[model samples]
Target: MSGASVLYDAPGPKTKARNRLYSIVGAVAVVALIAFVIERLGAKGQFKPEMWNIFNYADVRNNLRDGVLTTLEVFAVAAVLSLALGVLLAVARLSDHKPVRWLATGFVELFRAIPLLITIYVLWVILLANRDALGLSGNGPQFWALVVGLTAYNGSVQAEVLRAGIVAVPRGQAEAAYALGMRKTQVMTTVLIPQAVRAMLPTIISQLVVTLKDTSLGYIITFEELLYTARQMSTNIIVNGSDTYVPVIIVTGVIYVAMCLALSGLATWIERRGRRTKTGVAPATAAPAGDPATAADTGKDPAATP
Candidate 1:
């Protein structure tokens, strides 16, 4: 029997009908809940056009712009650093040396076990304490704290992802590399790393999206990132005698969703490109026009015989 059949039998007609009905009922319930929320919000004047009008103000727009730029800056730096760190950690974890293996394992397990928020908070405190000694200026301390915390956590996760991919690679590939007189470092760098990255690209991008979203955590350290700026706008701005919290939240949420969607789209494009990439050994060079070994292999000169 197939594995799926062993797990559970295929649903009968009655069971399938029941499942369809359940899905319909669940969908109706969700729609009703959404309608109810809309009605309530409408009654409270939260859907008023004026609520969204705050974005028209130069100051509000500028704040949002700055917030977005800052968030992207942190994400870009953290993503690059995290990927780099992940590669090193993954290689070290797979090292023959017991010390290196143990160190990488402990580091990955330690950071991955700790909550990301706590890590960011602790780093912020430490950086703040020694800002002068580190030559941190302006938002330097907050920025580095958030970036480093993200790098540590996401890098650990990515290391495990890469390690899984590396392990999944056929053992023959490494054996072949060794047979060709490739050193361990050369085999890893030129052979293993590229394949592991290609195989694990989607998971890596997903982790990067998480890293992007987590930039919002910088707000806890009073960093004026997009989410932080949005929070301020939501609380401070008023429209029709109520704080513009709902509209601000909705707009901010939309922006965040758009960003994630864009990232996902970019990842999809890259994945498609990677799939289309030429791979495997190059086609053997055409036997130099009239080589005798080529003729012998073919039982005659291919050019003359065929």
Candidate 2:
């Protein structure tokens, strides 16, 4: 048996048999539940050819394509802005200055505590109300509202993640840097932040995935994103005397899953690349004050060196 089994006694034959039995029962129950759901959906004609055929329409396909593009645009802007804001907030929170740390803490806490949906909706309303004064037009209000709300909420979460990663670094590394006469800013930027980023990359990317998914909230403000477009298509399209809501929803949900998986894959690739790269500080060496080599380099004899 593996040493890890010391956490608990190894299972006896009877225990193993019971575990297998439980697993089989759970699997059977899950299969039965899925079968029941499929039967009901089929009865409702959701699996019919006509229901699934709506996606073949050029207009529907164009709407989905445009929706995906818009979603990607909002996600890209929000992800970049949020990461920048997160780094700033994290640095501020780590500052030796008390007021700056407190202000950063307050900002992070406030946004983290608020509901993201409400934040987005409120921003949308405010932007729409002041559209002319803000020089906003077209989908500008919806886009900005979604982007800013995502930035605020995800930025706070990422700040916490980065702070935790920084704190997790060994104190010895910072001490060594200081011993080399490095300033706090230099140590943080050159040593701490790089290590922290590598350690917290997975968490940062996960928050970004949440930001992408949250773009669906734009539907509430009529931003014409994937979810909003799906709703629009479902409502307007009739298939075999019924609405094509299920098929449209299924396709939209699949698209979301695909995008999130792609983000995860990208994060994994970056993590692998980081692991392959060299990290940490290189030690500095100094010659003894009276060494012959040092004295010769300085054009002075060692015996005559002060």
**Residues 134-191, candidate 1, lDDT per residue (tens digit)?**
9998999999999999999999999999999899887877887898899999999998
Candidate lDDT (C-alpha), each? 0.87, 0.88
Candidate 2: deviation at residue 271, Å?
5.3
Where does candidate 1 stray beyond 4 Å? 1-28, 269-306
Per-residue CA lDDT of model 2 for 116-223, tens digit only, reads: 999999999999999999999999999999999999999999999999999998787788789889999999999899989988897789888899999999999999
What residue pairs clash in candidate 2, if any at all? none
The 10-residue segment of model 2 with minimum total lDDT is: 278-287
RMSD of 1: 6.6
Model 2 residue 185 lDDT? 95
